[model samples]
Target: MPNIEQFTPTEAYEALREDETAALVDVRSRAEWTFVGLPDLAELGRDTILAEWRQFPGMTPNPSFLDDMTRQMGGTTPQTVLFICRSGARSQDAAIAVSQLMEEAGTPIRCINVAEGFEGDLDGSGKRGGLNGWKAANLPWKQS
Candidate 1:
């Protein structure tokens, strides 16, 4: 909450593109990234960092999330890193959690939350990715 910033999916993408040191951290589960698709940052000569905030099948919180994220991101925190999940909730939590880890390691990070997330809000029929989100924004993404 201290150093974390919140942005729309488009804003997050733009910020990452503009800042060479910034990285987009997708906090969704591996299943979501694989089945539901994930953002494609290939044009920026980068990839979306997969640091799941929660585990699949059991949907349990990954206790090693922060540690794993630090390792995944190569220890040095990016100037601006966005955390995104299926919805904004988890990513917001991730931003806070990652911030603490970054501080402990003396690697101050600008943790950001993609407020609309990857799937976006549920539509009238309760479907995802249509109302508003990374996918809804029509940003580059690919199914794995």
Candidate 2:
């Protein structure tokens, strides 16, 4: 329903590097962020917005997601907002939701999804990290 585009992890990273006003939102749970890992944007002098799309334990949608986004952005103007999740589905939904909201609000922010996601799809060995994701794409990341 909104103008949400899909981008590979590398493309998204490049866009973020090129666009000073772009945002990289990680819509993963706190547990995943702590145990799995997170994108390290420190080299670019930027930080990923760690906003949970869903709450942990029960995996419920976060009611204050937009609020958290707004707070993380410090009430800045809407710009290129990128969302990423475990295997991409959740972040895609999150991007669509945010895109629609921004459109309704007349801001029309560019919402993009890291389609391969952070951890990526499961491999033939039933693993994730080794698959096509942010980490697998060889993007900068750090363990928390």
Candidate 3:
């Protein structure tokens, strides 16, 4: 089995609501977050952590990703962390990396890839956010 698990946006939202130790991490670039909007976790009394798995423009991997995650998580280490991006791919990579890191730290966590992500897959018109994502599912979200 892979180090990470996969869940649809609705499933992830439910898990986050049910599990107090569950948290979310958005791995899209800052530009994407600003332009495409962000997941709203305020209802859960939490805020989604923002960290780039890959930087904008060049799309280069962010060297400080793990560090940023650790810092953003602070003293409270969540038992479950859901990772989301524009689509599922990048979030999966982020989930795997974090899973490995947490296991190595002797604090194994359930790292989940929000499979459909915030924007989901492309539509017939070659666009996203309308098929099967967090936004499409009508989950809480907002623009920056």
- lDDT against the true structure, per candidate, is 0.87, 0.91, 0.91
lDDT of 2 by residue, 1-144 (tens): 776799999999999999978889999999999999999999889899999999998999999999998898997745789999998999999999998888888888889999999999999999998879999999999996
lDDT of 3 by residue, 1-144 (tens): 456888999999999999977889999999999999999999999899998999999999999998887688895668888999988999999898888877888988888999999999999999999999999999999997
Of the pair 1 and 2, which is ahead by lDDT? 2
lDDT of candidate 3 at residue 16, scale 0 to 100: 92
List of clashing residue pairs for candidate 2: none
lDDT of 1 by residue, 1-144 (tens): 475677999999899888978988888888898899999999999888888788997889998887777687787667778899987999999889878877787877788899999999999998998999999999999997
Flag clash pairs in model 3.
Answer: none
Candidate 1's TM-score reads 0.93
Say what the RMSD of model 3 is: 1.2
Best model per lDDT: 2
Task: Arrange candidates, best TM-score first.
Answer: 2, 3, 1
Clashing residue pairs in candidate 1 (N, C-alpha, C atoms within 3 angstroms): none
Q: By lDDT, highest first, what's the ranking?
A: 2, 3, 1
